[model samples]
Target: MAGLLDIAPLTEKVRVGGATVEVSGVSAGGIVAMIARFPEFRMLMTGKDVDVASLVSMGGDAVAAIIAAGVGFPGDEAQEAAAARLPLEAQADILAAIIKVTLPNGIGPFLEKLTALLAVKGGAEALAKVRATKSH
Candidate 1:
């Protein structure tokens, strides 16, 4: 998870099911949307001290890596079974943790589609910790 946060090696791969997927960079706008709602995204635009276009162009592989890391289980069957065995809340917790560790700012409001269940279960604290951590 920590490794996923490092955006340097743009070609890194993570195991997902039986095949390997490359973790590519994501647009900076995408990154902002990932951690916060559009209404609140201005913080990301200004707070990060980054060039909007450059940050957007920064890490295409990073997004893939974050998702791959979120679904950490290997093997298609195993990943499916793992997801099935856990309650949606549990899955969200796992997913949120993965995103939090993978992204410098933590999971964005855009991810409410995925982490809505997690937000109900102390998502604030989880996000706080992720925010506290420094990303490379």
Candidate 2:
């Protein structure tokens, strides 16, 4: 059997582009509470139809990919190795670690608190302070 065909169905399953943003976003009502501090992350998560459900579902697949890519014979070892010194196994493990927290319950409280914070403070002031202030 061909390997490309193996991934073809999995590819069709994911409507969104990738897992990082989507899954991370889902962990916070699909808004990416972690990204609230970063300007670029703010921009991406500030959208309306961020598709939290899709992200949560796709997260598992993404994490699996990360783990699979870590072994010596990485899934994309040849092409990825050429671009950078990322070992097949190591990079995958790293990616998996980053995505690990995007789980369901893990993000619920974070989303609620983030919403509360955003409601009171909003993004404008959050971006104001250059240094860590007494009150955020």
Pairs of colliding residues, candidate 2: 25-30, 25-32, 70-88, 70-89, 71-89
TM-score of 2: 0.27
The reply for model 1, stretches above 4 Å from the true place, is 1-71, 106-136
Model 1 clash tally, residue pairs:
14
lDDT per residue (tens digit) for residues 72-118 in model 2 = 22345353343144333434334444334333234445445656776
Q: What are the RMSD figures for all models against the true structure? A: 16.2, 14.5
Models 1 onward score TM values of 0.27, 0.27
As a whole number from 0 to 100, the lDDT of residue 103 in candidate 1 is: 51
- Residues 20-124 of candidate 1: C-alpha lDDT, one tens digit per residue: 445443444444544453322333432344233332233433223323334542324444454455543443344344433445443344444334655788575
TM-score of 1: 0.27
Quantify all predictions' global Cα lDDT against the true fold.
Answer: 0.41, 0.35
User: Candidate 2: lDDT over CA atoms?
Assistant: 0.35
Compute the lDDT of residue 79 as modeled in candidate 2: 33
